[model samples]
Target chain A: MNIVVIDYGMGNIRSIQSSLLYLGVKSVIVSSDRNDILKADKIILPGVGAFGEAVREIKKRNLEKHLAEAVLKDGKPILGICLGMQLLGLSSEEGGFNKGLNFVNGVVTKLYGEGIKIPHVGFNQIQVNENSRLYNGLNSEPDFYFTHSFKMTSEDDIGASHCVYGSRFVASFENNNVAGVQFHPELSQNNGLRLLKNFIERF
Target chain B: MLRKRIIFTLIHSDGYFMQSRNFRLQKVGNLLWLEKNYKFQHISFSLDELIILDATRNQKNLSQFASIVSGVVNDVFIPVAAGGGIRSLADADLLFKSGADKIVLNSLQYENPLIVRELVEKYGSQSIIASVDYKSTAEGHLVYVNDGSKKIEYSLKEYLTYLEDLGVGEIYLNSIDKDGTGFGYDLETILNVKDLLSIPLIIAGGAGNEKHLLEGLKTDGIAAVATANLFNFIGDGLPNARNHIISLGENIANWNANS
Candidate 1:
């Protein structure tokens, strides 16, 4: 299968490529090319850094349109990680009010609670949704590495899995072929690898 | 719940990985030797994060260190933070392109505040880690930079506040006296500064075994515990240590080994 990792000139793409290769994926291409993304069997959107800059880059490369067509219209399975996950939502409050890809019904904002740390960095256990394809074959409560200041919040039932740092927030969400994870599964060890494998096979 | 982390720090000088004692470097082996001994690909499964610092004292090369980092973290599936001579955005870009999820800054945090601000503005505070190396003295904890050669003006507490003000995501506090001693983490020092900052704290420099790891993790307000001792947790030492730490009922991430 052709696995295309969207490269919008941000975040670590090497680790995701390396992880796929380790999982016996023979063809994994990192590209921002529209054709490459459209032609792929599956897509992985990985990102880090500021939300405003990431959204601006995506729009600059016309990735916003291409991704919408591929994932929404074409019904191709796409997995967004970290800021990539936030990008799939409606908007983010990182720098200022910035719009996202809006694949999932959600909004991104800074995590707030009494006496909780900002940029919650470390591995934390996630309460996986029973119907989550990305969390299949994992423990009831699996751990994934998360590093972010802003988190996605939603009232819609997008099959969201929740994790509590200071308060409960969306850890991951799946809606048919469209999925997004707040944590970095590529950096989450065995459970991460397993999730990637599930996305490749199940999704 | 947000779980604590166990970080393994690799100190690289020139082309070889070194075993550091009180900030003094002793060459251990090359990349081949490191792979043969540590089996990082397999052992990385036991770790929450990996930090590789280019501790090359003289004539530091960014490209060379980036190559080593890229090569070592090939199949290792963990958040890797790399630094040691990152002066410009291009240098930070090189490491990010190479495979670093976050950039570690020590001297630059003090020497250049503009670049630090720019990096924070560009990559957000979470992508930058402020590494503080200090030694307990007769007067107080004295901060050091430039690979522990010179002492800075700020005390440990004052320096941490400076890093926080600079918008660094995390603080990597290492004790020069306790480093590589295998004695355990300087808990007293850690306690002194743990509650002072709002950002995540990663304490380094004196973990000898799994028990030390447990002690550090068990402490309140510590986000992570880091160790750069190359020989202490060799082979299955890390895996065993992690298993022991988990067995102690500490709140850590658990993965299915069979998966």
Candidate 2:
């Protein structure tokens, strides 16, 4: 099976690539090429930077249309991380306002004020949701690495892993072949590796 | 059932937030050598204690610092604490605005002396953490701040008593000589500080193994233990650190279950 990691210069591509290799999966880094998206068995859009930058890059490359058609029409599995996860939402309050991939019905909001931290950096616990293939065979309620300032508040809670900082936020969610993680799985330790391996094996 | 209290510290290299790097060393070929020798990723998702410090240690302009704090707290999943170059109530407020769970202040306690009491009045004692970095001096033990940039004349006893009077929540006690050493925590320091205050204290610097963690837990006044080496152990091509720590903790819990 051929796995393609999307490259839009807004992600931790090399680390994600290295992790896949560690999982014994041979994955190719895909660019803005239309043929590449259509050809791969699975596509991974791993991101690290701001939400607005990711949306702009996706639109600029016209890969947004290809991604929508591929996932909705072609039934390809696509996973997003951090900003990539926010991109799966319909919109975000990152800087001003911006549109997202809209694969999931959600909005990204910034964390602020008392009992709430903005970026929410470092390791945090993950409360596993029912029927989650992403957390299959792993111990329940494990710590996952995180680094971001925005979180997705989805309309529906499907394949959700909930964790509370100041308020309850979506840590990870899955709908059909589309899965999103607010934390970086590539940066997570053994549990993160298991998550990546699960995605490679099942997705 | 009691929920596991999670602690998060944001690790910063120089000024920019990074995974882990000691500040005392300078290597011309280190970055390139690191890239070539090992697979280094800047923000790996495996961290329990994340700490961010101003690499420059600039005390004045806190707006820029607050912006950095604002940028990191939204996505992280744990209790986040920040320390370094803080000197006033306004500085503490800026850190709070930026999303810090606890504002760790050291020299500011001595500089104004009344600021801790004022902060306790405004934000409560739990939010204020009096940070101390102590070292063995010719006279005795000296507590200092700014990563030991200046020496404070006050002894650990006097400082802890002063903070308790101010009603601060916890004491973040660090040892400069033991930092980045991995030798183990300064047990004597904990013993000495524990005698001075009834409030919770966190022991940082030189945590090398599970044995060290066990010792820290046994210490009287310690609330938690913090380490940069722990994160480096897992994400740094070693045998995944988080899994190892979790497994170690589980083993101890199980042993206690049988006992």
**Highest-scoring model, DockQ:** 1
Model 1 per-residue lDDT tens digits across residues A1-203: 88999999887789999989989998999999999999999999989889999988998999999998999999999999999999999999989999999998899888888898888999888988887888888888888999989889898999999999888999999989988899998899999999999989998
Q: Candidate 1: where are CA atoms >4 Å away? A: none
Give a tens-digit lDDT track for model 2, residues B137-197: 6777887766577887778778778767776667777777777677888888678667566
- Candidate 2 local Cα displacement, residue B77, angstroms: 18
Model 1 per-residue lDDT tens digits across residues B44-102 = 98999999999999999999999999989998999999999999999999999999999
Clashing pairs in 1: none
Q: iRMS values in order, in angstroms?
A: 1.2, 12.4
Alpha-carbon shift of residue A37 in model 1 (angstroms): 1.4
* Deviation of model 1 at A69, angstroms: 1.5
Candidate no. 1 TM-score: 0.98
True contacts kept of each: 0.79, 0.03
lDDT, candidate 1, at A14: 91
Candidate 2: Cα lDDT at A41: 82
